[model samples]
Target: MHVPDGFIDAPTSLAAGAVAAAAVAVSLRGARRELDERTAPLAGLVAAFIFAVQMLNFPVAAGTSGHLLGGALAAILVGPYTGVLCVSVVLLMQGILFADGGLTALGVNITDMAVVTTVVSYAVFRGLVKVLPRRRRSVTVASFVAALVSVPAAAVAFTLIYAVGGTTDVSIGKVATAMVGVHVLIGIGEAAITGLTVGAVVAVRPDLVYGARDLRQRLKLRVNGELIDAPAPAAAPVAARTSRRALWISGLVTSLVLAGFVSFYASSSPDGLEKVAADQGIDKRTEKHASADSPLADYGVRDIADARLSGGLAGVIGVGATAVAGTGVFWAVRRRRTGDVSPTAVENV
Candidate 1:
């Protein structure tokens, strides 16, 4: 959930900011290992896709809705470190460009949404992948379960944060009850989305899916009453066409549909956190976003009379911008990694 300003005190926000900064720093370093030629470009698309889908909040309860946190989906499709970066990029974009999440509370949102969700989901996913049958189905199953748990985990994290630095004197029990309750319903949606998306990617390009990489066990066959491993499939030649044009185009189209068109049909009610805050009096101390005056504030362009057209245009712009920014960052990271590994650079150093 997007935590607005004034929900947490200044000192707590600063502390969370330090934590978020440290996490982002660590992720940047770890992402060096995760980013490669094949995945570097896809990582950006994943971030933009997450940003767009999050705009489509689904109904969870009578007055509460929830959106994709994207941690599990990112971690399964990309890698944990890169997943954190993907989500952080989306949060940063939303705060500065869309005025959706508060700038002052950026650290809190990053910590709860980006760091906690990615770490928890990836840990659970890895653990499941270790124990379950090593198959594509297991990867999908793990993605589903990991996503299901990450939402409540984030809710618990927020509850704890509120308990420590809550601006209002709401009952912790009530906050936890409401937060966990509605988020659990939201987690179901998250699980389904994560499963379906991960399954689709694993089907088309299992090579691109980080979580399913090791699941590609060699085929086995019985010959002359003895079991023998079958020969590996011919590896796609490095020179073979390696174009993601189709995937990127399809992903952008899907993002546009979800954010521009489908979002209109999404629940008009507040999301899980917003509903809890309103119900528990947490909103009593909430502050406005720092970028509230931005042209794209509230996901609409300034002076746009047609709600549908304005929202759709904003969605398309956001998707394109996010993809470009994310791809640029990932490509830079990949380039740096390549340079570091280059023989000339290694020798020069």
Candidate 2:
């Protein structure tokens, strides 16, 4: 959920800002180990895809809706560190460009939505995969369960943050109950979307899925009545041609379609957090976004007569901007890391 400005007190916001900064710093370092020749480019596509899917808010309850948090989905497709960065990139873009999230409360949103969800979901996913059968289907199953849990975890995190710095005099107990209740329904939707997406990717090219990378069946060779491990086969030529370029183009196109077209049919109901805030009196002190007057504010172009055209153009612009920004950040990280791991650096090490 995107926490708006004035929901949290200044001191608490600053503290959360420090925490968010530290998390981003750590993720940047860790992403160096995650990104490589094949995965670095997909990282950008993952961010853009998350941004697009987030635009399509599905109805969760009679008057509430929820969208893809994308933490688990990104982590399963890429890696956890990069997944955090991916969601963070989407949050930053939405805040500054679309005024979807508040600028002053950026840290709070990142901590609650990006950091907490990624950390919790990835941990749960890895743990489940370890115990479950090491198969492609198992990866999909674990992804569904992990995504199901992450939404409530983020809801709880926000509740705690509000308990500490909530501007209104609301009952924390009631707030927590309502927040968790609605988000639990939202989590089911999250699980379905995540499972299907991960399954699709794993089916097309299991190699591209970082979370499923370790899911390999050890072949046994009956050598002289003794079973031993068989040597790994070389990469097939056809499989070698299955690069990220095709996947990247396909993902980008899918993102464009979802944001530019399908988003128009998305439920207009308030999302889980917005509904909870309104019901719990948590929105009593909510402040207006600083960029509320921006041309692209509220995901619509300024002075565009047609609602469909204006919103569509804004969505397209957002997808493009987020993709470029994410690509730039990831590319820089990859380049810097590659330079460090060159022959000279290896010798020095």
Error of 1 at 98 (Å): 0.9
Task: Please state the error at residue 58 of candidate 2 in Å.
Answer: 0.7
Per-residue lDDT for 93 in model 1?
91
Q: List per-candidate RMSD values in Å.
A: 4.1, 3.1
The best candidate by lDDT is 2
Q: After superposition, how far is residue 44 of candidate 2 from its true place, in Å?
A: 0.4
Expressed as tens digits, the lDDT of each residue in 85-105 for candidate 2 is: 999999999999999888889
Clash list (residue pairs), candidate 1: none
* 131 Cα displacement, candidate 1 (Å): 1.4
The candidate 2 region of ten consecutive residues with least summed lDDT is 232-241
- lDDT string for model 1 (50-156, tens) is 99899888988887889999999998898999999999999999999999877888999999999999999999999999999988889999999999999999999
